[model samples]
Target: MTRKSTGIPGLDSMLQNGFAFPSAILVAGEPGTGKTTLAVQSLFHGAREGEKGLYITAISEPQWLVQKFLSSFSFYDQQLVEKGMVNFIDLGPSIAKNPSDMLEIIKKKIEQYQPERIAIDPITPMTDLLQWRGETREFMHELFAFLKAFNSLVIITAEMSYDDIAHSQESYMVDGVIVLSYPEEEKVRRKFLEVLKMRGTKHTTGRQLIDITDEGLAVQAGLR
Candidate 1:
């Protein structure tokens, strides 16, 4: 199977070189666990390798603010964004008003940008579109189908803990699941990345130590 490098060597090691192509990966984690950082870093990596990347944000946060913070990471390139190698789009307002139109809007963006790598910053908001679990499942089914129609590796970020994700439908639909977490081991706070599942790949099974540095997020050689 063809794989796409995440650009983080240690992470790539854990992932068996990289994520499988044309697959959706659910990135579950709480706030400030480097969810966005990992997604953006991968996108920028693909951009350097001639793969177009599209970043779609579904939050109310200002795009400028998002870019401002992401710019601090060394892998983030203003030049790549300026040249259209990396594209950014905000679906926050539309999703806020009508959560149902998300599928169509995403399809339109993909058609317009034609990116080879796509990242849906946070997909948890769609859970509120309907009251019944059945309806949510149908929506997720359609979304996954639509996502697979194109030849792109998709990253879907969610603000949820591992336990929360274990009970969520989105976790089961995606081709891969990566969880980032912060737990108090002894007396200090540390970050971790775990590859919970990856279809057809023998990935590392345990929570691996990770660090956020000036360049970007990197998986350490230790496991927690």
Candidate 2:
């Protein structure tokens, strides 16, 4: 299977070169876990490689705020954004007023941009739109089906902890699950990256130390 490089050398190595093409990857972690940074970096990298990229924000933050924060990262380029290589759009208001149309909104944007790499940063909010027990699963089924047919590398970020991952219905709906956590060791808290599950690919099994520098996320050598 063809793979899409994550643009992070260490992570690409961990994923056996990169994520499987046209796969839906769930990036679950708590707030401040660098989920957004990783997703944005991936998009920007793809943009640099001449791939059309789209970033859909489900969270209630304005686009400028997101760009402001992302400006700190060296990998983020204003030119790519201006050239329409990487587009950032919000799904917050649409999902807020017409939750039932969330899928349509996403579909419309994807159809319009025809992006090769797409990231839905923090997909957690969409869960609240589900009114019943099985609605989330059903919704995810439709979402995943759409993504598979689109034939694009997809990254869906969620606000979740290690504990929540076990019971998250969303986890079972994706092709892979990457959990990021901040674990304390020797009285110091450090960020760690772990591939909880990846289908059709052999990957590093345990948590690896990660550093979030100005350039972006890099998997460190050996756990400190």
Which candidate gets the maximum TM-score versus the true structure?
2
Please write out the lDDT profile of model 2 over residues 27-76, one tens digit for every residue: 99999998998899999999999999999987878879889999989999
Runs with alpha carbons beyond 4 Å of true place in candidate 1: 129-134, 222-224
Scanning candidate 2 in windows of ten residues, the lowest lDDT window is 128-137
lDDT of 2: 0.89
* Cα displacement (Å) at residue 16, model 2: 1.2
List of clashing residue pairs for candidate 2: none
lDDT accuracy of residue 1 in candidate 2: 96
Candidate 1, residues 1-224: lDDT per residue as tens digits? Answer: 99989777587777778988989999999999999999999899999999999999878689999999999999999999999999989988887777767778878999999999998887776665543434677778888888888899999999998779888889889999999999987898999899999999988888888989988998875452
Write down the lDDT that model 1 would get: 0.88
Superposed Cα deviation of residue 155, candidate 2 (Å): 0.5
TM per candidate:
0.95, 0.95
Cα error of candidate 2 at position 58, Å: 1.7
Give the Å shift of residue 206 in candidate 1: 0.5
- For model 1, state the Cα shift of residue 212 in Å: 0.3
